[model samples]
Target: MTETTPFGIDLELDETVAEGHYSNLAIISHSTSEFIIDFAAVLPGVQKARVKSRIILTPEHAKRLLRSLQENIVRYESNVGKIVIPVPSSPGDTGPKMGQA
Candidate 1:
């Protein structure tokens, strides 16, 4: 069943979608019109990681997502201390690698 929000939008979640995928790595690529984001899980000692989900958004919506994330991250850090990111071990290694399409 779908629930109507106070703003009069209907939101629905199914069983499979409610049980979400776990993603530790994200690969992002963009073209002239759209942005593609691939979510993957990388396991320790695993040689290869498969992308579990791919999301495509328009350039404008992608920017909106970026802004929303920034705002949420600020609020999260305020409540749970600042999150620290580790530096890459090697010069060739960059954290959370991004690719161009």
Candidate 2:
């Protein structure tokens, strides 16, 4: 079943998609017109992490997503306290690097 939101877009979520995937890392790459984001899960002692989901968005949509995330994060921190990101322990341990195409 699909429902129409106030924006007049019909949205549908199947059972499988509703369960969702867990991702600890995201790799972002972009070209002039589009952006590609790969979501992955990395486990301890695992040598390699596989990309579980890949989302491709146009540059305009990607910018919208960035703004939406910034707004939501402000609201989230207001209620749940500030979210902290830990610095890398070593220079070589920098996490999640973005790539260009």
Candidate 3:
């Protein structure tokens, strides 16, 4: 049986999913009832980018996730230091990797 947590239930991570996907970019689209997030990798100078993973969440769940991420980011910065986001050198430059436009 899966154990229960104060916030929710325990999650089981399979070997395949535990490895995780490497996503350099994320594309998000939403409708009236749900939101879709597509994770992808964009290599520098490459014209095409492939979507690695897609996750669909309800509007309420999405908002909860946003808050969770915000809290985690604050804690992470407090422990490791502020994350420096790099600015692209050119207008069209999309950083180290330039995936699908």
Candidate 4:
């Protein structure tokens, strides 16, 4: 087991990606040893429920989390077989990975 340090969290969220002038927004929060994330979005012609994404954890909990995720990934891979890695293209590749004009 690894020892943990007391750390703080800060979020730098930019809502510029949201469409038009209606942008949903939020701030990140945390306690001394745990971090939290709250994400929200507003839909057109609908009441916006305060959808939240909360993650609370210590350092040790983080390792256990990786283990759990890896376990599920292993199971998924066993069912789906090998997966392909996306090949990164070089410049002048004429792919959609390039920005729109």
TM agreement with the true structure for every prediction = 0.81, 0.83, 0.83, 0.38
Q: Which of the two candidates, 2 or 4, achieves a greater lDDT against the reference?
A: 2
Q: Write the per-residue lDDT of candidate 2 for residues 11-101, one digit (tens) a residue.
A: 9978888789998888888999999999888777687999889999999999999999999999999999999878889997865533322
Error of 2 at 89 (Å): 3.9
Q: Write the per-residue lDDT of candidate 4 for residues 7-71, one digit (tens) a residue.
A: 54454445553233322543455567764544555455566545444456775675586698789
Candidate 1 residue runs with Cα over 4 Å from true position: 1-7, 89-101
Each model's C-alpha lDDT? 0.85, 0.85, 0.81, 0.53
lDDT of 1 by residue, 1-101 (tens): 57888889999978898789998888898899999999988777687989999999999999999998999999999999998877888986654444424
Model 2, runs deviating above 4 Å: 1-6, 90-101
Write out the backbone clash pairs for model 2: none
Q: What is the C-alpha lDDT profile of model 3 across 1-101, one tens digit per residue?
A: 34567879797767788789899888888899998888888787798989999889999998998899899999999999998877887897655342222
